[model samples]
Target: MGEEPREHRLATPEGDICWFEWGEPSDRPSLLLLHATGFHARLWDQVVAALPSGFHVVAPDQRGHGRSFRPASLADWTANAAALLPLVDRFAGRPLIGGGHSMGAYVLTRLAAERPGAFRSLLLIDPVIMDPALYAGGDAAPVPDPADHPIARRRDRWADAEEMRARFADRLPYSRWQPQVLADYCEHGLLPAPSGEGYELACPPALEASMYQNALRTDPYAWLGNLDAPVTLVRAPAGPREGGLDFSQSPTWTGLGAQIGAVRDELWSANSHFIPMEDPARVAALLAGIAANQG
Candidate 1:
């Protein structure tokens, strides 16, 4: 199956591990794409197409979301190590270049810390991290669990793509996107259910919100010195100020690039947190260059 998708299952403590892979099998250096918390691997579709066919791309549906089964807590990421680590050897013998968004990026760093030389270069796009207090440390103020936050579980039924698109376009949080792009997001965002149909979020809001807080247990910064892989950090420049709104003040994630200078000697600033989907051509170009170095 040259350039065809291949999937495999691995028995893991979290449940069965499921991963989606594609691109030419003979592609020189391997590139693995990992998505953020509560996201499916398909999120990288646009970015993957612009790459050289000689490059093999493997996108894993990280544990607890997408086709992969979920465990009771976010800590299951560590348990799936068996399934994810061997992938480096089973697919590409050499340290493969890895890129991930948000928690997926965090996972890559954890792997690098635990298993040096597993990846050659690391690309982290708008990762959601900070001192564990945001989720784990003593100073971290406790926010009510999503099991209690209604906005966290705002259930909805979409009659069709237009309805979903229009609804998302109407919302302010995503108001940053172009209308057509927003529509495309809504279209790809929903999954079908039995009969009348229920929409499934590419990310469960509660899970998305919880992982950051829960991530306090793992600190990639403290362990970055151990990893042999070269790292690159990319982020957006501003906060609510750009949106002309006072809401949420400076979105705390805006300055991640400035602070992560040690692990990532360089940072690429973008216009928003949704960088992969927004200006993927640039990301693809960046990854293409990365592939060249490893090749």
Candidate 2:
């Protein structure tokens, strides 16, 4: 039988962070899962359901997304990491395995570095950390204003969940996702509009765009050596070449494994940046393996 998750909300410095928990509160070790920029805690539901019994799992909706309280402004990944510190503290006296996707992966990396003993191991799926060369001279190219970004301009309201699902069923990235995953996204990734007329994206477009704009404000490469636990980085296939930019591929820096203290890197050419939603079974297996090894 699949494990059922319990929903929760915790007070944090940033805001009230919402999360989901699986398994009993025993000494079975804990896994902390963080979702990507525009995703929620429930995004890991599939992975959590597939995990082995007798293990505790927690997944949080990051600030400014999902059911979590939204902050006025998110400075960078560091700020988000700091806000999530309390959740990490919950696993203080036990084995904690950390895993995340894209922006979530970046946050986990930062948190593990800042608190080396907080996690026993890490699984980073297509983390968005950029190459050091891109940060040479401390120069990051300017990002377009959030209001002007394409993501910010996404259609917010829909007649209902079915309408939203139908609209995205044939969309680029959403279209590629597994059917159940897509259903989950449509179901939990939206909320009834404040006006009660329709449903709108749980993660506001403007907030998501702002996050993308500040994606490079903090660099994780500098602290890679501080991590003492084993780490696995799963990267997606290379994106197609555009004029000097490739938006369809993994954003992780090359040679990241070698630079980190103890790391193993794997590439999933068939998956895109959304590895968790694309293949939760594979992700669950990876997390289960890491947890089992710690026994």
Candidate 3:
């Protein structure tokens, strides 16, 4: 493990976007890690721990997650990337390797395209980009009512991190996670309750649900093929094409790898959509390789 990350926050109109930093800048390629929706940046602690020293690393809480601002609604998914533009610009000094998971990957794709030189390369881990067909013709899935969404119904309160860990230790997707990664998730995933008792989810259930409901609204295909940087897509096993948020399987389009000009597709059948959490060491190794090649 490396030195503990130093927490920092950047003020935004909505509120503040919290981020974590590690190591000092040097000639080496800088790394930025983006986490999946509903998950905070600290969830990447295990992966960062395995990374080599002497390279600057950053992990942000995005807008509506972790210690960041809690907006009234998160229906506009593109807003996250927009909010992160400044941070990306500031960290692009050295060659930057952007590593993102799921929604974070989607956000980085947008940033990499919008700000050409902001990223030297991208490592997209199980990004939630759906089949291009869904975005080509018309509107994607209709935004569901926050009140009626399944994720909205998730439990919001926990006695403590230990309780949260104990409750989810045997759960499906969580059970597959590396134990320490799961521990990191629980440890930093909670915030003090407004009532001054116990804790509530750092990402409110309704907001997280709203983000999911509008997931397909922000399509990355517009600039996906136009990206100048090399991209590596790590995908989980293909599951039934049927609908629903099946985290056990990947949500990435099967043909996505072939769609990009400079890309590599790696299908890891043994893991689920949470590849980083399932295997942080391998993810770290892959990032280190990309940094080495780009540096």
Model 3, global lDDT? 0.87
lDDT (Cα) of model 2:
0.81
Q: How large is the C-alpha RMSD of every model relative to the true structure?
A: 4.5, 2.2, 1.5
Q: On residues 1-295, what C-alpha lDDT tens digit does candidate 1 reach at each position? A: 2354577666665476667677656646677888866557766766776676666788877666666766555543454444466555565455478888766777777767777766788887766555333444523445437465443565544666677777767576467554545664566556665464666664566665556445555445566556677778876554434332222222335445455453553334535667676667778898888778775
Model 1 whole-model lDDT (C-alpha atoms):
0.62
* Residue 16 error, candidate 2, Å: 0.7
Clashing pairs in 1: 135-213
Best-performing candidate as measured by TM-score = 3
Residue-by-residue lDDT tens digits, candidate 2, 67-92 = 98987655466888888888888667
Residue 233's lDDT in candidate 2 = 86
Rank list by TM-score: 3, 2, 1
Q: Candidate 2 — which residues are off by over 4 angstroms?
A: 137-144, 240-247
Among the numbered candidates, top lDDT falls to 3
C-alpha local distance difference test of each model: 0.62, 0.81, 0.87
Candidate 3 TM-score, true structure as reference: 0.96
- Please report how far candidate 1 places residue 122 from its true position, in Å: 0.9
